[model samples]
Target: MITAIVVALLFAMLVIGTPVALALAVSGSLGLYMMGGTPMLMGILETTPLSTASSYELITIPMFILMAEFVVLSGVADDLFDAAAAWIGRLRGGLAMATALAGAGFGAISGSSTASAATLSSTTIPAMLRQGYEPKLATGVVAISGTLAMLIPPSIALILYGIIADVNIGDLLIGGVIPGLLVTLTIILTVAFLVWQDPARAPAGRSYTLREKLSKLRVVAPLLLLFLLVTGTIYSGIATPTEASGIGAFGALVLVALARRLSFGAVRASLLRSAEATCMILFIVLGAHIFGYFFTLTRTTNDLVALIGTLEVSRWAILAIIMVGYLILGCFMDQIAILILTVPIVLPVIQSLGFDPVWFGVLVVVTAEVGMVTPPLGLNAFVVARYTRRPLGEIFGGILPHFWAHLIVIALIAAFPAIVTWLPSTMGR
Candidate 1:
């Protein structure tokens, strides 16, 4: 009953719009106090904050953010987007399709949905509007495609899940590569199909020569190199995740200079943004640890396992039930909050069922991608709406069809877990 009350309070705090970190901290602290009084609460809170904050792996959080910030401001992403437009803007709905492709490129670097959505929406929407594309088509594509940021490598969501679930972070990241590419392909195919059926939505585009396309690729070379550097080093076991991030940050600086895009102003702004993002992520991590401590004290995992055992259902059915629960939560809550709150509780059950941690981590991220595009609480959708000054309803309308693309990708992964598992298994463990 007490565990039930604590869970209810936590959900209440979330529903009332308290920051996720604060909601977690308050509910956790309360549970600790109730369990063993003031001294216990103080001990748990004090140690958790320190230990969680001091993790060496945490250093990469700031570094990754810094790399993304510098890359965003370096004008490289705009170059890439323009290049994509030049390459594929000739088909019906080609511009919108290019925007989604560009979202994938930017996502590969940023590992952030909001950054991908805002950046692409600002650049793509205006151009698409000028070209006579429908507003909903333009906005919806950006919102849904931006979610690829979390699916692709160096993903902040995957990093958090790997940490929380005690999986190999590098393996988890590598595992996302195939599924991420599959999602990108599906989105592109969806765009082509939509455009083919209704040419009125997006007018036929002008063709570009092969020479022109190759020439445009020259401008975005450095950004591609940086991706190879970071991801390659990790895959080859030449650098740890943290070291790769540091190198990536340095690589970003070099690219900015070589491209004649560096300025003190950009550097300062990037630093400020990185600092702010790092603090927010760290606070959530700290709060999760605090909440996890209290949750363990209540022995919830054991209870949950016992409850599951009572049901004579197959473990596969149980997995489906969990996925459905996550999807429902995705429609209403923040993805990161859902991840932090649930991983600790489910890790034991997952192990009991003999599920692979890395594969499960990929599925967790895929499910979160659905939330990034869903209505009412889709962060990427909201970012697009705010930046484009469109009604949230219109954006949600645009998102509806593309949303199924996300579900299809998830279903594909669920049917063939090997898509996620094979790459990680090849990694040098």
Candidate 2:
């Protein structure tokens, strides 16, 4: 009953527009008090903040955020889109395809989906619009492509999942590579199909000469090198994910400096933004730890796992139900918040069913990618709408095809976990 009340209180606070971190902290503390008096709550509060903030793994968040900020400020995203356009712009719906390809490339550097969305919106949407591409197609491609960042290596979403699930952070990062590429390929194919259905919706872009196309590659070489350095180090076991983040940040800093784009203002802005984002995530972590303490005291996960063991349903059915629940929740909540809040509850059950946590981590992020563009609170959709000034309805409608693509990708990963596990398994071998 106490567990039920605490969970109810948490949801009540969320429905009333309470900040997620605060909602978690308050409801958890209240639960702790109800069960074991003020001391238990106080003791938890005193330790959780320190412990959560002090996690060394958490350093990856800020470094990667700062690296992304630097890369954005350096105008590499513009060059990335341009480079992709040069290679693929001659095809039907070519610019839209370029946007997807560039989105995946940008995801290699910037792990934040909304950041990827905003950047693509500024760079690709106008280019597509100027080319006479349909607004719905243009905006939809940008919004959906943005989600590639969530699955790609250096992905903030996967990093958070790793930290939360106590899984190998390196393996999780490596695991995301193949799945991310698969998503990129699927998104491109979706664009191709959309254009094929009505070429008028996305006319072919100007053809580029060999010289011009080759020259564009020069612009992206630095970004490519940076990506190889970061991921290669981790895969080769030369650096942990956290150390690789520092290397990535430093490399981004150097790239900005070499381009003569570095400035006091840019550096300061990057630091401040990184700090702001880091603090927000840390607070969420703190709240999750507090709530987790209360939850563990309730033995909810263990009981839930045991309850599931007695059920006669096939494990696949249970897994599908869980995936469906994530899709529903993804529409209403932030992806990171969903992971932090739900992983502790669901992971044990997943393990009990004989699923690999690393594979499950990749699957979780893939589902979050779908949520980023889903209605009501599709954060990526909002970001696209903000940048393009399109109606939310049109943006949502535009993403309909891509939304189906995401569902298909999710289904593929679920059916063949090897897609997610293969590359990671090869790491260090």
Candidate 3:
């Protein structure tokens, strides 16, 4: 009863538009106080914040953010889009395909959905529009493609899940590579199908000379090198994720310098933005830890898992229900908030059923991707709409095909968990 009450209170706060971190912290503290009085409350307040905030792995967040910021400042996203256009621009729906390719490449470096969406919106949308692509197709492709960052290596979502679930961060990151690529392929195929069905939606782009395409590759080499430097070290056991983050940050800075795009103002802005984002994430982590303590004290996860074990249904059925629940939640909540809030509750249940947590993590991020383009609270859709000045309806409409494509990718991973786990198994060190 008390556990239900606390959960209700948490949702009540959320429904009332309270900040997620504060909602979690407040409900958790209340639960702790009610269950154990002042002693428990004092103990939690005294220890949770310091421990959560002081996690060394936390350093990776800010460094990666800084790296992304520097890369953004250097305007590499524009170059990536141009390069993608040069290579694939002549195919049917080619410009939209280029957007997907560019988005995947940017996602590799940026690890941010909204950032990817905004950048693609600015660079790709205009070109697609000028090429006579329908507004819905142009905006929809950008919105959905932007979500690739959530599952790609150096992904912020994957890193956060690793820290929260106590999984191997590097292995978790490597695990996402194949799934991410599969998602990229699916999105591209979805674009082709859309164009095939309605040739009027997206016109073919002009062809470029092979030499011009080769030249464009040179401009993207620095980004590819940076991705290799960051991910390769982690895969080869040469650096931990934290160390790679620092290396990535430095590499991005060097790239900016070589491109002659570095400025004092850019550096300051990057630091400020990175610091702000880090603080926000850490605070959410702190809140999640507090709520987690309260939830554990109540034995809710164990009780739920025990209850689940007695059910007559197959594990797969229960898994389907859970996935559906997440899809619904995605429509209403922020993905990171969903991660910190639900992972603690759902992971033990998943493990009890013999599901791999790493595979489940990839599924969670993919569901988040679905949420980003879905209606009501599709954050990526909103970002695309905001940046491209497109009607929200068109943005949502455009994403419908890709949204189904996301569902298909999720089903593929669910059926063949090896798609997510195999790469990680082969990683060095």
Candidate 4:
């Protein structure tokens, strides 16, 4: 009964256009009322948001976000994309491949999927279109590749999953490396395959001399340094993820200053944007905590776990089902909301079935990456479409091959847990 009310209220709020965070909070409060009456509901209202927002690790989110904003505003993305283009743009469908690689590099610092999509789309789509790249392929590459922001290290989603699941944040961060690279390689190969099949759409390559290539490297040098500093600090245990983020943010500011891109106006704008994004994410997290607490009080998660345990399905079968469910849900929901709202319920079942929380976290992130490219609610696709001024369908069609690439990589990760676990485990996490 409590579960039913909570579900209904949540859907009702969503359907009526309540902000997602508020909807979660409202539904959670209603669930508490259903389970423990008014006083408990009020108590939840007081404590849950405070507790959820008070997390020290979560501080990394806004700092990383700020770093991304500075990078974007400071024109780092353009330089990075140019560097990628100089090296790879001579191959068939090279621009698209370059976009994917650039997305991976930007993902390192940005950590936010939507921001990545928006920033990269703004930076790359216009150049691709101007270069006579097919609108569908160009937009698709940008949209799908932007999903990398979530799989790469310093990802806000991975960090949140670690916090909620009690998994090591460092391990979760390291765990993303292999899967992230796999997705990148898969997307690149998919682009190659598509270009081979449809030669007309494949533009002739632009040849660059060795001097040109070497000169372009200068454009990306700062980014490489920033990557080393952030990921290096974390992996070396020189700083926690939060401290690494702080260092990265400071580094970004310095980069922007050196690039002569930093101004009082840019700084103010970045801060405002960061604050807005931080509020949206933190609010959803707080609401999810309330909802999770209410669900626990109603014993729904425990009941669901017990019921699933009674089923005759194998653990892998159940895992497959959960991934499919997340894929469908990802199409309509924001990834952060999906992670917060579902992880609490799904994770217990996963653990009961004897899966490692670390592995499952990576699985969940990769699945959510698929959602970012799926249609209707695919935030990345929408952003790309808006930036390129292309029809949504074209962008959707273009991203299809890359979507399969993501799926193939996901399968590899599923079949071989070592792919995702090796780095983090070797790190002794």
Candidate 5:
């Protein structure tokens, strides 16, 4: 009952618009003090923030964010969209497919959903609109395709999940590649299917000659090559995830310089943005640690695991329930906030069911990706709406098809865990 009340208070704070980091800290500290006393609260505050914030592995977050910021400054997203559009510009709903593809490429480079969605919405949605595509298909594809950023390699979500779950970050990142690619292809096929069912949704895309496609490819190839070099080192056991992030950040700078777009202002902007983002994530991590410590004292996590184990239901059923819970929660909260709050709570049950942590990480991430496009508070949907000046209702409606695409890919991964695990398992780690 006390555990339930603490959890309820936390939820109430979030619902009332309290900042997540602060809510976590206040609720957690209060819970500990009430349950254990001032000594306990002080101990948690003293150790949790210090230890969680100072983890050596935590440095990877800022490095990756810096790299992504630089890549954004380099204007790689525009080139990616142009290249994908050129290569696949003739099929029914081809522009949507290109958006998905370009989103994937940008996800690889940027490792952020909002960054991918915002950039693509501003760049591709207008082009699709000018080509006479339906608004739903145009805006929906951009928003849904942005989800690939959270699933793909160098993902911020995967990095945090790995760190929190105490899994090997390299293997966790590699594990995402297949699942992410599958999600991308599934999104393309969804667009194709939607257009096939209603050709008016996307009549046709502008055709590009082979030469034009090849020429456009040059704009994005260097960044793709940079991604390959950095991630390749990680897969080949040549660099840790941290080192790879540093390499990626430097490579992003080089790519920008090569494009003659690098400037002191751009670099400075990237640094400041990355620093802000990094600080926010670190604060959230510290708070989650303090909160997680309170859960340990309450024994709520252990009790929940035991309770679940004692149930007559199958593990798979329990897993489904968990997934559904995530989907529901996704509708109401930011993915990062949801992860920080729930992962520590449910991880014990997940492991008790004998699920692979890496695969579960991918599943958790893909589920959260749905939130990025779902209604009421879908961040990506809002990004699309803001850029296209479309009604939020229409944007939400447009997102459903892409939401189904996410469901289909998630089902495939669940059925064939190897779909997410094979690549990472092959790594030397």
Candidate 6:
């Protein structure tokens, strides 16, 4: 009865066009009231939001987001993409491939999929279109590849998952490294394969001189340094993810100043955008906390855990089911909201089945990354389509290959947990 009310209220609020955070809060409150009456509901309402927001680990989110904004405003994305294109654009479908690689590079520091998609789309789509790249392919690649932001280190989703699930943030961050690179490489290979199969779909070549390539290297140097400085610090235990984020944001500001791109107007705009995003994320998180508390009060997670234990299926099969559920949920909900809502229920079940939390977090992140490129409700796809002005259908179609690539990687990681665990284990994190 509690579950039904929670689901109904959540869907109803969404249908009526409430903001996601407010909807989560309303639905959670409804569930709490139904299960424990007004006292429980009032307690949750008074305390949950503050508790959720005060988490020290979550501080990484705004810092990473601010770093991305500064990088974009500083014109760093433009330089990175330009350098990427110069090196790869000569090959068939090279620009598209380059966009994926560059998106991965930019994602390392940004850690926000929407921001990466918006920045990359604004910079690369026009250039690719001018170069005679297919609209669907160009926009699709950018949209899908931008999701790397969530899978790479410094990711906001990973941080949230770590905090909620009590997994090591460093482990979750390192766990993503190999899988993220594999996905990027898979996208590149997919583009190469498609172009090879139908050469006409992508124009041939424009080789650059050695000097030209070297000249462009300077353009992407700041991005590389920033990535290494932030991720390297985390890997070396020199700083916590939150501290690394602060360092990254500071580095980005310095880069902007060095490039003479910093201005009072730009600084104001970046802060405003970061604050808006941070508030939206925090509200959803707070609502999820209330909802999670409500679930606990009703013993929903406990009941669900018991129900899963009684199932005859193997744990691997159950894991597959959970991944599929995330894939479906990812379609309708934003990544952070999905994590906040589901992890409380799912993590207990996963641990009961003997799976590692860090590995599971990576799996969840990869699946959610796919949701970013999946149709109709994919925020990244929408951002790309809006920016490129391409028919939404084309962008959706273009993402199919990359989507398959991500699924393949997810399967591989599932089959061989070492892929996700090796780095974190090696670091003793």
Off by over 4 Å in 2: none
Candidate achieving the largest lDDT: 2
List pairs with backbone clashes in candidate 2. Answer: none
By the TM-score metric, which is better: model 3 or model 4? 3
**Candidate-wise lDDT, in order:** 0.85, 0.92, 0.91, 0.86, 0.87, 0.87
lDDT of 4 at 269: 95
Tens-digit lDDT track of model 4 for 115-148: 7888888888887777787787788888888989
Query: How would you encode candidate 6's per-residue C-alpha lDDT over 305-382 as one tens digit per residue?
Result: 999999999999999988999888878877887888789989999999999999999999999999887865899999
lDDT of 1 by residue, 313-354 (tens): 888898888888888889898898889989998878877887
Better of 1 and 4 by lDDT: 4
Instruction: Point out where model 6 deviates above 4 Å.
Output: none
Report the C-alpha lDDT of model 3 over 1-429, residue by residue, as the tens digit: 889899999999999999899999999999999999999999999988889978999888998888888878888999999999988899979889888888889888888788888888899999998989999999998999999988897899999999999988998888988998899899899999999999999887889998999999997889999999888899888999999999999998998898898889888988999898888988889999999999999999999999999999999999999999999999999999999999999999999999999999998898889998898999999998888878999899999989888888889899999999998888889
How many residue pairs clash in all the candidates, one count each? 0, 0, 0, 0, 0, 0
Q: Which pairs clash in the backbone of model 6?
A: none
Residue 419 of model 2, lDDT score: 92
- In the range 230-342, model 2's lDDT, one tens digit per residue, is 88899998899999999999998988998898899889988999999989998888999999999999999999999999999999999999999999999999999999999
Estimated TM-score per prediction? 0.97, 0.99, 0.99, 0.97, 0.98, 0.97
Q: Candidate 5: RMSD over Cα atoms?
A: 1.2
How does candidate 1 score on lDDT?
A: 0.85
Comparing 2 with 6 on lDDT, the higher-scoring candidate is: 2
Candidate that beats the other on lDDT, 1 or 3, i.e. the better one: 3
